[model samples]
Target: MYRERPAGFARAVLWTSTTAAGAAPTRVLPDGCLDLLWSSRGGLLVAGPDRTAYLSGGGPAERWVGLRLPPGTGPAVFGVPAVELRDRRVPLGDLWPARDVARLAERAEAVPAAVLAEVAVARLRAAGGPDPLGARVAAALSAGAGVAATAAETGLDPRALHRRCRHLFGYGPKTLARILRMRRALALARADTPLAEVAARCGFADQAHLTRDVRDLAGVPPTALLPPRPV
Candidate 1:
């Protein structure tokens, strides 16, 4: 089973998942976000932003908890540039002191979700909150703005904007825009909108363009990503 709720700080999400024995692997599609994870078996870890889908494995029945930090808020909470952790999962100790992380891991063994939220809220406060630029850039791109237009709207030249995005989102603005657009297309499809209309509404050149883009990022076609229709 899987469920999620807003974390009440920094636009993050608190999610939990539990798998039965021999459960199938989960395909986690890219969405330009980072996660702070706690496992019944693995303790505390961090999940970095991915350029493509990540296939998460399952084994014996176990519980997992995570705080999903929105794009651009990760560096503030994790104390490193997003690019440094891209496409990787590492022990929280690798970034913070082992002694401190170990103590927190012990607490997480009892109430994992609360520990994740406490760590994020504290770090974010110490850092004076997430940078406003992240929200602005993400909003413009999600609203169908082109990369050049987003750059102008954010008041940065193309080169400067790209550099900032790399540090903040672990990729350039163009890649982030592509990921966000793919997410938008999938959401529209889930509403039972026709694929062609989804493609047009999401800024794709056509339905074919949408298919190729989704395949490149998700390693599957749009139809495969969507849930099955009713009988």
Candidate 2:
């Protein structure tokens, strides 16, 4: 089972999931976000922004609660550049002082969602909130803007934009744009829209283009990720 709600702090998401013992691994598609996680068995860990789908480890049944921080927001909360943590999951203890992580872990174990939200709020407040540039770049790209256009909108030259994007998102703007586009296409697909229509609406050149991008990012074809259409 999995559920999520807005964190109400910095556009983050509070989520929880439980896997049955011996269940197949779950595929987690990238969405340009980082997660602070506490599992019933693993204590506290941080999931970095992923460039591709991450397959969860299959193990004994376990419960997980996480705070999913939006792109650019994580550096403020985690005190680390997004690129350093990209495509990796590290224990919170490795990043913070062990003693502090221990106390935080205790609170998280007692009340996972609330504790994670509290920690995020405190950290973001101390850092003066996420960089405003992140929101602008993400909005532009998610709206189907090209990288150069997005850079122009954000008032940054190409190189400067790429540098800032590496610090804010785990990758450059072009990669982020592709990831966001794939997510948009998937949303339309989930609404039962025709594949060709979804491709057209989400800015793909064609259904084949959509299929290739989805497979590259999500590790599966669109049909495998969505429910079968009725006859």
Candidate 3:
């Protein structure tokens, strides 16, 4: 089971998940977000923006809690470029000094469940705020705007947009747009929409286009992504 609620910080989601019985290995599809996770059993892990799926083994009764930071918010809070974390998960000690990481780990282990969110909120306040234009850029891409159009709307030229996207979303504007579109398609598909209609609604050229995008971004075919439906 998985559930998400507001993280009480700008541009973040607080989520928790428990593995189901006898589940096989699962892969997390990229949705252009970064995560800070705390496990009672696994400690702290920073999930970078994944260009492709992230795989992990699991079974029933494993509890996982996390705070997912939206694009552009991570650089300030994590003190690193978003690009550095692409397609990777790193221990906090790798990015910060050992003492700092140790102190953070101690704090996280104390509460078991809520400490990660507390750490995220404290970091948000300490960082002053998230990227001012982050929301606008994400909105434009999510709405299926082209990179050049997003650049024009955001008052940044194409080259500048590419640079900012790398720092903010861990990729270029085009790739971010692709990721967002695929996500849109996935949401629609999950609602039982036909692939042809899903493609059209999400700005794909056709069902075939949608299939290719899902394959490219998620490393799986479209059928493989849809969950089993009840009769």
Question: Per-residue alpha-carbon lDDT of model 3 for 130-161, expressed as tens digits?
Answer: 77777789999998899989999999999999
Count clashing residue pairs per candidate: 0, 0, 0
N/CA/C clash count, model 3: 0
lDDT of 1 by residue, 56-139 (tens): 866787788999999899999999989999999999999999999999999999999999999999999999998889989989
Q: How do the residues 1-231 of candidate 2 rate in per-residue lDDT, one tens digit apiece?
A: 999999887788999999999889999999999899999999999999999999995889999999999877888888998999999999998888999999999988789999889988998899998999999999999999999899899999999999999999889999999999999899989998999999999899999999999999999998899977688
TM agreement with the true structure for every prediction: 0.98, 0.97, 0.92
lDDT of every model, 2 decimals: 0.93, 0.92, 0.83
User: Scored by Cα lDDT, where does model 2 land?
Assistant: 0.92
Clashing pairs in 1: none
Error of 3 at 182 (Å): 0.3
Backbone clash tally for model 1? 0
